[model samples]
Target: MLFTQAKGRNVIALTTAESLATVTGIAIAPAPARIAAVRVKTRGPGTQVTWNDVHSFGPDAVTVRTPDTIQGDQDTTAPTDKHHDPIGKRLLTETGQNLGSLDDIDFDETTGHIKRLIMAGQDIPGERLLGAGTYAIAVAAP
Candidate 1:
């Protein structure tokens, strides 16, 4: 059994099922290999997601880089100054009121764009708050 390291955190196998077998040792099997580029695609607080390796043996793994955090584009005005945190620690109402804190955010699967902002509220609305799509979210802090 032999292995080679590619890029920064990837391993290239030199035998049939080698990569898949290696991955299986840790968890599940790997997907077939394809010639393409590897990228993180998108990132948020506590999480750094990866996209189709274009060269991996599995359907990209959304590795959890950190915990208790969310990711979104900055430069857009939040409900308030508190809503201008990278990890989203504050929650603002459409009427300029502090409702609760931000728990996490969700994104569109295929596009890797923001979908919703999960707030840490209880009696206000659903556990999962809705978003106005990426256009509504900017990577800038308020």
Candidate 2:
């Protein structure tokens, strides 16, 4: 399992499920001898819940021993790859305002991949505020 940051949020993946349903297939594969399941763990001050490794394979069945008990399952949901805005593409605001163009992306330093866009906007005095609020900055797409 792998833990990554996407859009300033943590993304959990058993395997790279970017395309072709990659992670889902591997998770349901026949259990290996030593490796039972893949567990995705999030570590940091802002994240939540930690435990010993969890098996990726689903349990056959379960029955509650005590009354008023609940059962929960954990699995990594696939990442969104809409690709509406291609890399280096320019996107405008809903109000038809020239917000900015996509610059580069900032990835998790530990993971070494893109996490957020490094948008560069026009050099207006007040415009900096707009850029600061945006995950995508307004700059010439390169």
Candidate 3:
């Protein structure tokens, strides 16, 4: 599933399947896990939630944080890890063939691990990726 699709989906509790909050954005860490946490914008005023404390995630929603205690993070604060915003970054093969700009990321819904990169509506396998830098994603030649 693409991260874009996960955004805006209602976050439901795993145990009860009860609605908790709405997803706002995701924070990707530079670590091997890829997705470090999720940020949720709750329904009430002054309420927000972060999924950093949670350990488990499903395809559609996460199974953490209740509706009442979920608090929001400072809007200006950024994630503390080294990260890259892949969207709009150019995609290139090892031999320098231009594919397209990155559109979205495809990830494992169950494990929260990034599976592939979506560029020009195509799926590029994670293993083919050589490097994801500030300007472009270098992939192995086909």
Candidate 4:
């Protein structure tokens, strides 16, 4: 699913099917290129859970093993210092070629792996993603 579309999905517990929070954002880590954590809105400051804690990423909701899986905001930091925001970051190639601006990321919710990168008129495969910094998202040249 598109990360953008999954933003509002409910975060629930698998055993009880209880809704814990609403998905607000996702933090991704580069290098291996996978989701590091899922940020959500709870009654408190905020909450997040690591990808390993995620039991399933279904169409309706994301499931976790238990409520204990959720972590407070203090434990959830930026996926990395360089990549703060996933949406609207400028896109650039490793060779310094400009692609465009990032629109949304196509990711496999279950595995937390990116599948594609969406832009104005191009849909670049996720494997092309190299890294992202505050300034721009870098992709490898084809």
Better by TM-score, candidate 4 or 2 = 4
Which of the numbered candidates is closest to the native, going by highest TM-score? 4
Candidate 2, 2-64: lDDT as tens digits: 121122222233343221111111011111111112122223211111121221212221112
Model 1 scores worst on lDDT over the 10 consecutive residues at: 21-30
lDDT (10s digit) by residue, model 4, range 72-134: 756655452224667888889999999889999888877888888899999988878788667
Q: Show the colliding residue pairs in model 4.
A: none
Report how far residue 125 has shifted in candidate 2, in Å: 16
Clash pairs detected, candidate 3: 48-71, 48-72
Query: Scored by Cα lDDT, where does model 4 land?
Result: 0.81
> In candidate 4, which residue ranges exceed 4 Å CA deviation?
73-83
Candidate 3 TM-score to native: 0.56
Question: What C-alpha lDDT, on a 0 to 100 scale, does residue 64 get in candidate 3?
Answer: 64
User: Where in model 3 is the C-alpha error above 4 Å?
Assistant: 13-18, 31-33, 43-52, 65-85, 88-99, 127-142
| TM-score per model over all chains | 0.29, 0.23, 0.56, 0.84
Top candidate, metric lDDT: 4
Model 1: number of clashes? 13
Which ten-residue region of model 3 has the weakest summed lDDT?
Answer: 75-84
> Compared with the true structure, what per-residue lDDT tens digits does model 3 show for residues 1-142?
7878877777666556687777666555333535545666655652334445453555656666554434544532424112344567798998999999878878776566677878765888766767666567787877
lDDT of 3: 0.62
Cα lDDT of all candidates, in order?
0.27, 0.25, 0.62, 0.81
